[model samples]
Target: MLSSALKAYVNAIDDPYTIYMDTEQNSGFQEELKGSSDFEGIGAVISKKDYYIQIDEIIKGSPAFAAGLMMLDRVVMIGSGLTKGLDVNQAVSQIRGPK
Candidate 1:
């Protein structure tokens, strides 16, 4: 599951952005297969000025859908062992795979 802070970051944005997935050789593919095949769990690129946590487009079910996440929901934490920092690059890293 994604951290609350990361979720909040996604929920606070209100703008048209592109979500991308990293395709690195080291990334594990078996784990990604555990989730829905349709959604490869990729990274997103939201606008910087879009409040970062509260906006209209940020709402769930919208074009910028976050699968199970909702809009305006702050992401306060992530991962199990360590509280990893939440950023666009990090988000992309999580969803990316070996290409």
Candidate 2:
């Protein structure tokens, strides 16, 4: 109840990238973001939280950055809502692609 209420407050704030992570998840995420992977997206790093997709970072030179996407932008609708209601995995699959 407490965490849900807190999350609701934060979610109301409009910063999509900020999500509460427990200690273990935070530590693992810390290690993961420091490394490189061949995965591709709109040049933005994102994670799926409870009900929304969170964009963590926009690579400086990536297309997403060029398009003016900023950190903490909740993905509301994508591709004219073609990807709406998709789970995190499905959303990522639709948004990410080969560069």
Candidate 3:
């Protein structure tokens, strides 16, 4: 309701990284930062930028690094679908696991 509106309004502004997280989300984010790569992935740091998820960093020796996915690479598609309208959270979920 109100929270969603506020979040949407804030995210609508110029700051692409501006975001809102609940207690569960905050805790999950912290946990995800500490060795959550047990699952297979390309090993790239992604962030919200320009209405899409952009590669902020590529871990050395990671599959993403091996695949030549460098910093600032715009991820327009995840798997077979386009990322045109997906939010950061949606993109992150899609990016997780073996993909």
Q: How high is the lDDT of residue 36 in model 2?
A: 44
Report the C-alpha displacement of residue 41, candidate 1, in angstroms: 1.8
The C-alpha stretches of model 1 lying farther than 4 A from their native spots are 1-39, 42-68, 81-85, 95-99
TM-score of each: 0.29, 0.53, 0.58
Q: For candidate 2, lDDT tens digit of each residue in 52-96? A: 776776767777889989887778877767444567667766775
Best by TM-score: 3
Q: List model 1 lDDT by residue over 1-99, tens digit each.
A: 344465456546733352222334114223333444554443222222232322112333333365544433443333442223445445444434443
Better of 1 and 2 by TM-score: 2
For candidate 1, what's the RMSD?
Answer: 11.2
The predicted structure with the larger TM-score, 1 or 3, is 3
Once fitted onto the true fold, the runs of candidate 2 whose alpha carbons sit more than 4 angstroms away are: 1-39, 82-85, 97-99
In model 3, state the lDDT of residue 30.
52
Of models 1 and 3, which has the larger lDDT? 3
